[model samples]
Target chain A: MAKIELRGVVKRFGENTVCDGIDLDVSEGEMVCLIGSSGAGKSTLLRCINLLEPIEDGAIFLDGQDISVPGLDPQAVRARIGMVFQSFNLFPHKSALENALLAPRRVRGQSRADILPEVEALFARFGLADRMHNYPDQLSGGQQQRVAIVRALAMRPEVMLFDEITSALDPQLVGEVLDVLLTLKSEGITMVMATHEMGFAREAADKVCFLKDGRIIEEGPAAKLFDHPQHAETQAFLARALK
Target chain B: MPHQQTAGPTRRQIFEARQRRKSLVIASASTITVVVALIVLVPLAPGWSKVQQSFFNGAVLAKSFPKLLDAFMINVMIFAWSAPAIAVLGLLIALARDAKSPALFPLRIFGAAFTDIFRGVPVILTVYLIGFGIPGLGLPRPWNSPYIWGSLALVLTYSAYVAEIFRSGIDSVHKSQRAAALSLGLSERQVMQDVVLPQAVRNVVPAQMNMLIALQKDVSLLSFIGPVEIFRQAGVFKSLMANFTPYVGAAIIFLIVTIPATRYADYLMARQMRERS
Candidate 1:
C-alpha cells in the first residue's frame, strides 16, 4: 500500500464539481507537485487528502487505513497528515513555539516538557530560533510560512501537504521559504505541493502533475514532463510559461 | 519691498484671535450655566446648619443605612452571580451561533429571543412580573429570592448584547485562521478552544468590559424587585427626612462605584485601540 492514496476522489461544491475523479498514489517519500491554474481543484484535492474538504465520492488511505469514510474522525487523520496553507495560518495569539506545540500537546497528548525539546529542535532546524518567542504578526511572511511548516512537522505526520504555501509571500521572501521546503524534501519528507513556481516544481518534485479542468492532463518524471510534451495543452501551457 | 508686504492679517494672528473668541464664549457660557444651576439648586442643597444637624447623626442614617446596605449588598450579590453566568451563556451562545450547527439554531434563536425580549421589556416590568406577578401563576414564587429573580432579569437583558459582542469578536477572527487550524487536523472543538476563541476573546476584551460595567450599573434597577438596595435606602431617607441629601449621597456612592468602572473601561478601550492602531 502506498503511504498516501486517493482513489476515484470526487468533490463538488453546490452546483460545481471541483475534483472530478483523482487517482494518485504517493510513496513513502515522494514529493509530488500539482501545478494548475487557480480553481482547477489542486487545492481542493489537497484538502480532500487531509479530509479538510470532504469528498462526495472516493477513498483516501493513509498507510492503508481508509480515512475517507464519512464517520472517520478527520482530526485523527489530520494528526497523521499535516498541511501548510498558502496564508500561513499560524494562530495569531500564539507565539511561533506555541503554534508548533499546539497539536502535539492537544491531539498527541504530549506534555510541554516532552514536546518543548522537539519543538525547539524543529524551530532550530527551520532557522526560526530567534522568532520562537514572536507571534505570527511579529514575523515576516517567509518566517511565518516556515514556522507553519515546522508546526506541521512537529506533529511528525506521515505525509505533509503544501497548498500554494509561498504564493502569498513577497518575491524576495519566496526564495527563503522555498529553500526551507527544499530542505524538508532533502530530509525525505513525503510532500504533495500545489505550487505555481515551475522551476521549484521541476527541481524539487519527484513527479510533476499538470492539472487542467479538475483532472490531471499529464503526470510523470518532472524532467520528462518539462522537456517532452505529449499533449497540446501541456505544450501551450509550457509555451505561455516560457514567455 | 520690505518684508515682502505680509498678507492682510498674518494667519497665526487670525487663528489666535479666533481661538481667543471661542475660548471667551465657552468660558462665559459655562460660567452663566453654573450660576443658573446653583440658583436653581440652592433650594435643594440642605442648609449647612441643617446638614450639621444630620451628618453623622445615628438617628438619620441608622433608620435608612441598614436598608441601603441591604439593597446595596443584594445588588452586589446579584452582580456577583449573574455576571459570570451571563458571560458564560453569552459566550456559549456566540460559539453555537458561529458554529452554524443546525441543531444549535434553536439555541441561537432562543438566546437571541431571550435577550431581545428581556431587553425590549422594561426591566422594572420584568422585575415586577417575575417578583410579584409570578406568584399568581399558582407555581412556586420564581422571584421569591428577589436577588435571584432580579439578577435573572438583568442577565436576560444583558446576555443578548453580550452574545452579540462575542459573536462580533468571534467573527473578527479571520476565516483563514479557522481553516488553518482545521488543516492542522484539529477537530472543530479543538479549533475553537485552542485557536479561535482565545484570539476572539482578546480582540473583544474592551467591549466585554464595557458590557460588564453596563451590567454593574444596571444592578441598581434590581431595587424595583424589592431588595431595598442603596437607591431604596435613599428613598426611605428622602421619605423620612423630607430632604434630597440622602438621594444625593446615594448618587455619590453609585458614582464612586460606576465612575471608576467607566473610567477603567475607557482606559482599557483606549489602550486596546492604541495596540490595534
Candidate 2:
C-alpha cells in the first residue's frame, strides 16, 4: 500500500474552493514535490493530506486506512505524519533540543532517557550540536527551521510534509536550510514538499506535481515533468520560475 | 591607556541640577505662608488643639491595633478567596468570548454587561444593595446581610475588569499561532489550554497584577456593609475617640498591601518591555 493517498479531495472556505478534487499518491520512501503559484492550493493540498485542513468532500487514506472520515482520532494519524512549517513554529519558551523532544516526551509518552539519544543525533546531524540549550529566539531563522525539522523527525514519522520550509529564510541563509533538507533527502525519508525552489524540485524530487486552479494539471517523473510540462499552466509556471 | 573625554552630562551634575531646582521651587512658594498661618491660628482657636490632637494622636492607633490587625486579616482572606476565582473566571470568559461557536456570542454579551454594570455602579452602593436591599425580596438568608453579599459584589465587579485584561492578552496571541496549533493536531480545548492561555496569561501579568492591587483597596468598600473588617473597626474607633488617628492608621495598613503589589506590577512591566526591545 502507498504511504498516503488523497482521492478526489475537496476543501472550501466559504464559497471559495481552495482544493477542488486533489488526487495524489505517495509510495514508500518517495520524495514528491507539489509546485504552483500563490493561491493555487498547493499548501491546502498538503495540509489536507496531513489532516491539518479538513477535506469537505473526498477521502484521504493513510496506510490503507480511511482517515478522512469525521470523528477519526487525528492525533493517532498525526503521530505517523509530521509537518514542518514555513514559520518554523518552534515553541518560543523551550530550548531547541527540548522543542525537538517535546512531542515524543508529551504525546508519545516517551521518557527523556529514551528520547535523548535521538534528540542528540538529530541536532548533530543538522549542525546544531552546540545549540541544544538555546531558545528559539536565540537562534537564526535557518537554525530554527533546522530545529523544527529535527523536532518532527524525532517523532519518527512515516511521511513528512515540508510546507515551504526555506521560504522564510534570509536569501544567503536559504542554502543552509536547503542543505539540511538535502541531507534529509539522502536519509531516504518519504517526504511531500510544497515548494517554489524549482531547481531543488527538479533535482531532489522523484515525482513533480504542477498544481493550478486547485487541480493537478501535470505530474510525472521529476525530470520529465520539469523538462516537458504538457499543460500550458505547468509550462508557464516553469518558465516564470526558471527566468 | 588612551584618555577619552566625554561631552555628555555627568551623572552627578544631572542629579545636583535636579536637586537645586526642586529646592529653589520649594523656597520660592507657599511653605513660608503655611508656616505663618499655622502659627497665627494656634492661639486664635483653642479647639485647634482638639483637631490637631485628634488628627495626630497615635494612641488610638496603638490601642486598637489588634482590632485593626483583625480587619486587615479579613481583607487578606477576602483576597485569597476572590483572586483565584476572578483569575480563572476571567480566563474562561475570555476563551468563551473568542470561540467561533454561535453560543459564545450570548456569553460574550453577558460578560460585557456583567462588567459594565458592576464597573459603573459604586462598590459601596453595590454592597448596600446586595447586603441590605436584596433581603426585601425575601430571597433567603444568603441576601440577609453583607458578609456574603459584600464579597459577592466585590468578586462580580473585579471579575469584569479581569475578564477584559484576559481578553486583551488572548487577543495579543498571533492568529497564526492558533492555526499552527490546530495544524499540529491539538483540539481547540488543548490549543487554548496549552498554548493560547499560557501566552495570554504571560502577556497580561502586569495588568492582572494591577487589578489585584486595585482589589486590595476595593475591599475597603466592604466596610459599608458594617463588617468588623479593618476600615469598619477604624470607623468605630474614630467615632468613639472623635479623632482621625485610627483612620490614618487604616490608610497606612492599606499602603502596606498595595505597595508590594505596585512593585510587582512595575517589575513585570519592566521585564516585558525589555523582552520586546
Candidate 3:
C-alpha cells in the first residue's frame, strides 16, 4: 500500500483553480519530487497532502485511511504529515530548542523533561547542538532553515512534505539544507517535495514528477524522468528549468 | 620604509574635534539667550505679580499638595484597576476581529462595531454616559458608584484603541508564520496563543505603553464624574482660595508622571528597532 495517496484532489482560490484534479501515490520510504514552472501548483499539491490547504474535492489517504473527509481533524493529519516551508518560519520569540520542543510538549502532552532528551538528540544529530539556545534571529539563514526542518522532524511524522524549502537559501547555504534532506532520506522517511533544484532532484529523488498548469504531466524513476523526456510540456519545462 | 607613529592627534581628528566644540558652543549660547529672554520678558508683562500670586504662589501650592496627592492616588488606583481589564478585553476583541471561523461572524461584527463606536466617541462623553447615565438607571449600589462607572468608561474607550493596535500588530506578522505553526499540527487556538500573539504583543509593546500613558491621563477625566481625582481636587482648591495655583500645580503633577512614561516608551521603541535591524 502507498504511504500517502491523493485521488482527484482539487484546490481553488476564489475564481482560480490552483490544484486541478491531482492524483499521486507515494509508497513507503519513497522520495517523490514535484517539479514545474512557478505557477504549476506543485507547492499547493504538497500543502493539500499535509491538509494545510483544504481540498475542494477528492480524498487524501494516509496509511490507507481517508484524511480528506469534511470535519476530520486537520491538526491530527498535519501531525502525521509534517511540512517545511520555503521561508523558514521559526517563531522569532523562541530559541531553537524551544521551537523544536513546542509541538511534542503541546500536541503529544509530553513534559519538557520527557521530550528534552529526544529533542536534544535531534539537535545534536542536525549539527545544531551548540546553537540550540540561539533564537531564530540570531541564527544564519541556513541554520534557521535547518532548525525549521528539525522542528518538523521532532514531531516524528510518518510522511514529510517540503514546499520549495531550499528556494529561499543563499547559493552557498543551499547545500547545508539539502544535506539535511539527504540525512532524513537515509533514515527511510517517506517524503514528497516541490523543488526548483533540478540538479538536486536529478541526483537525490527516487521518483521525479513534472507538473504543469496544476497537473502532473509526466512522472517516472528519477533517472528516467530527468534523462528521458516523454511529453512536450515536460520537454519545454525542463529546457527552461535546466537553463 | 618605517611607518612613523605620532603621539599627537591627526589633522583630520583635530578638525572633527573643533567641529564638535563649535556645535556645542552654538547650542549652549542659543539656549542661554532663550532663558535670559524669558526671564527678562516675564516680570515686565502687565499684572505679572498678580498672575504669579494667583497661579504660582508657593504657599498655596504647598497647602494644596497633600490634598491633591491624596486625590491623585484615587486616579492611580483607577488606572491600576483598569489597565489589566483593558489589556485582556482589548486582546480578546482583537482576536475576535481577526477570527476567520464562519461560526464567529457575529463576534467579528461585534468586535468591529465596538472598536468603531468607542474610537469615534469622545472619551469624556463616554465617561458622562456611564458615570451619570448608569446612576440615573438606578440598577444597584456598585453600579451607581462613580468610581466603578468611570473606570468602566475608560476601560471601554481605551480597549477599543488598544484592540486596534493589537489587530495591526497581529496583522503585521507574516502570513507564513501562521501557515508554519498550523502545518506543525497545532490547533488554530494553539497556533494563535503560542505562535501569533507572542510576536504580536512584542511588536506592539511601544504602542501599548503609549496607550498606557494616555490611560494614566484619561483617568483624570473621572474627576468630572465626581470621583474627586486630581483635576477635581484642583477645582475645589481653585474655588476655595479664589486662585488658580492649585490647577497649575495639578498640571505639573500630571507632567511629572507622564514625561518619564513617554521617555520609557521611546526607549522601548528604539530598542525594538535596534534589535530588529
Which candidate has the top score in TM-score?
3
- What are the lDDT scores of the predictions, listed in order? 0.84, 0.84, 0.92
Residues B1-277, candidate 2: write the lDDT tens digits. Answer: 8977779888799999999999988886778878888799775896877876886686777887778888899889887888888887777766666777676788877767777887798877887787677666676665566667778888877887888888888888887666655555556776677667878888999988999998988887888776778888888898887878888888888888789889989999999999988
Over 4 Å off, model 1: B1-77, B95-113, B133-143, B245-249, B270-277
Which residue pairs in candidate 1 have backbone atoms (N, alpha carbon, C) closer than 3 angstroms, thus clashing? B71-B228, B71-B229
The alpha-carbon lDDT assigned to residue A151 of candidate 3 equals 96
Query: Candidate 1 residues A1-243, lDDT tens each?
Result: 789888988999998999988889899889999987889899999988988788899888888989998987788788888899999888888899999998888888889999899899988988899899999999999999999999999999889999999899999999999998889888898999999999999888999988888888899989999999799998888778766
Model 1 chain A worst lDDT window (10 residues): A234-243
Docking category of candidate 3 = high
| Deviating ranges (above 4 Å) for candidate 3 | B1-22, B101-105, B139-143
**lDDT, candidate 1, B118-232, per-residue tens:** 6688867877777666545665555356776677777776777888888788888898888888877677888888888898898888888888877777888877767777887
Q: Pick the candidate with the highest lDDT.
A: 3
Q: List, residue by residue over B1-277, the lDDT tens digit for candidate 3.
A: 8988889999899999999999999999999999999999999999999999999999999999889988888988999999999999999999999889999999999999999999999999999998999889877777689999899999999999999999999988898899998888899899889998999999999999999999999999888878889999999999999999999989889999999999999999999899779
| Residue A154 in model 1: lDDT | 90
User: Tens digits of per-residue lDDT for model 3 on A161-185?
Assistant: 9989988989999999999999999
Q: Give the CA lDDT, 0 to 100, for residue B201 in model 2.
A: 84
